[model samples]
Target: MRIELVQLENIRSHVKSTVPFTRGFNCLVGGLGCGKSSVLYAIDFALFGDPLGRSYNYLLREDAETGKVTVQFSQNGKSYTISRGLKRRGKGISQDFDQLKLLEGEKLVASVKSEAVAEQLKAITGLDKDVFREIVWVRQERLKELLDAKPRERQKRLDELFGLSDYEKAWSNLAGYQREYEGEKRAYEKDPDVIGMEKLNMEYNQTAEEFSRLEIELQGIAKKLEEARKTLEEADLKLKELEEIRNLTEELKRKEAQLQVNLTNIEDASAGLAGKIEEKKNLIENFKQRLSTAENRLNPTRLGSRK
Candidate 1:
């Protein structure tokens, strides 16, 4: 993994710093206590988070309440950024897990999870903390010691760095594992199950036949269930139709009752109108009789007076 940039905020002697690195062999050349090593520490913290022999208090600036480190790097032609933070807690400083993040380009890969970031970084860079410290980021003082060391010691360290030791250890452990496996194999060979292999196969076949028969029965039951479901659906539809007819019948009954009431009211109104007509006819007949009497009396008076 190639580091492209390292950013620091309130880290050690630097209050704020942004150091950009190029593609190949970039070195930090500064006087003593010039915050050059602080940048390296920040990069490491950003990658692996508070490694062994380092603490949040060491990375965080003295008297500073908070600190942050952001590292941008590229591996296998894919860019990634790792950000981590530290905060003072009471008398001690601790990682601000809320600020832990790993991003690929603008896409977030991990957030607020140190373990997730470490795993992703391991996968991307193919370097764990040990390999990074031993091989990738060798200290200036440790460089002389590594160079002046014996060939055997140097080779051993390099083997550990390259993970050859793990393979060697696995090879060494395989002898014991093989012995255990052989013992278990012998025990398994003498077991009743292994001895009755042919009988077990026959039983398995019988069980398989029984399962097939059951499956056929289940299919038949499923067919019946489907037919029953269809019949139930038809019954429900018929029930709905009957309910609609019942509602219509009740509505017709209500209308018939209202029509009967209206017919009674019309009959009562017709009887009252007939009674008024009869009274008017009687009054007319009485007025005609009075008028006829008055005419007859006037005619007689006229005749007598004239005679």
Candidate 2:
């Protein structure tokens, strides 16, 4: 896992700051009280919600009302971002206001509360807080703490980092199983039932034969059940297709009704327009007749005028 960015707001001495990291060997160097360590803590808080078991109230700035941390990192070539917020409740008390969001390129894939966020982060980055602090983060003051630790402590840290603890657990489980098996074996050997081993062997062989026959019957039943399931699935698919066809038929009927209404509206409009055209034609004919009558009245012969 590689950190790409760490942002802090109202965390410890930092008001607002962002640090971008490169691919390899990025360092944080600054004077005292400049929030160099706070950046690391902010990264921890953003990923794990709480910073290394510290209280949320102590991590928030004294004068600030809220604190926020956002960290962007890349693991296995996929980018992720985590953001967390702490809001002051009253004097010397603060509560986690924001749930942790695991985002991939602005799309939230998981959101978890503070209690379960650490485990999610561990699963995502393959490192818990202890392994992270031990391997990735080295404080300026306690840089030699890992080296100066006792052998058991150092080995424990190493075991966690290298996953040797799983091996230890496996060994412990194997020893326990061995002890259990030995005890069972000793009990079987010391039992008085071993004296009638021949009779017990005949009974065991008979039971095994019965079990084999039942197993065959069970397999036949399972095969029939699988075939029945397939038939049911086919029937379900056909039902769905039938439902879709019914819906389409209803939609077609609705569209046909709408088409008929549109056709009726068009016929009404056409009839109204034809009526107006006929009225205009009658007015033109009347005007022509009136002009002809006036012409006939104005004729010279009809008025009895000299030539």
Candidate 3:
């Protein structure tokens, strides 16, 4: 987790101070009592709320009724902002629940509760107050004290600070683990399934052989299926060809019927034309015969018009 910025309002010696921090190691080099350490305290408060054994009077400004700290940080590529505020009651200072908020970017993830914000910050940064105090933020005075301490106390303190005591407790808890393991091993050996291993192995082998036989049969069936598919494809092609031939035959039949109708019409037209021509020839012959008769009966020399 990297702290990007810290804003302190009425916190200790700071009054509306905005301190920007870089990614890597940052040093707050200022003269004593310049509120440099107050910034660190405010950041801690913003992230984890109040630390144990620390008084609110040390954090809240002398006469200020309200104090707030906002910390903007980034963890695992995700940015977060957490704010915590303290309000002075009649005799005791309490958390300003209204100003408490944990935000991811612009979205409020937790609000109005110190426990909720602390839990969210712990989940986000993977560090609780204890871890932050002991490992991440070692106090300058405590370091000197640790160096000046006796060997055994120093070692014990170091173990507790580095979380080595948890390992010691875990090792102590494993005292009966070996006995439990032995008992479980004995029970496993006495299991009926373990005693029947040979029979199970023989059955497995027989089943494997049967599976191989079935696999071969499946391959034969697949081959037959492939041949059937090929036959169906060939049948489909022949059916298509037959359909085309049937269409052509039908067209030819229709054309033949049309030609027959045309031939009958031509024959009827020819017979009518022949009849008309014979009638015309007969009329001409009749007219000629009448003319010849008239010529034979009439005189050719003189006329009898006056008599």
Give all candidate RMSDs, comma-separated. 10.2, 20.7, 5.8
Candidate order, TM-score descending: 3, 1, 2
lDDT of 3 at 294: 84
lDDT of 1: 0.89
* Model 3 bad stretches (over 4 Å): 51-53, 90-92, 161-166, 169-252, 255-259, 278-307
Q: In model 1, what is the error at residue 28, expressed in angstroms?
A: 2.0
TM-score of candidate 1 relative to the true fold: 0.52
Q: Candidate 2: how large is its RMSD?
A: 20.7
Show the lowest summed lDDT stretch of 10 residues, model 1: 50-59
**Taking the candidates one at a time, how many backbone clashes does each contain?**
0, 0, 0
Q: Which stretches of candidate 1 lie over 4 Å from their true place?
A: 165-307
Per lDDT, the best of the predicted structures is 1
Q: What is the TM-score of each candidate against the true structure?
A: 0.52, 0.50, 0.68
- Predicted structure with the largest TM-score when compared to the true one: 3
lDDT of 3: 0.87
Kindly list the per-residue Cα lDDT of model 1 for residues 35-91, writing each as its tens digit: 998988888888888744866778889989999999999988999988999999999
lDDT of 3 by residue, 190-223 (tens): 9988769857989999999999999999999999
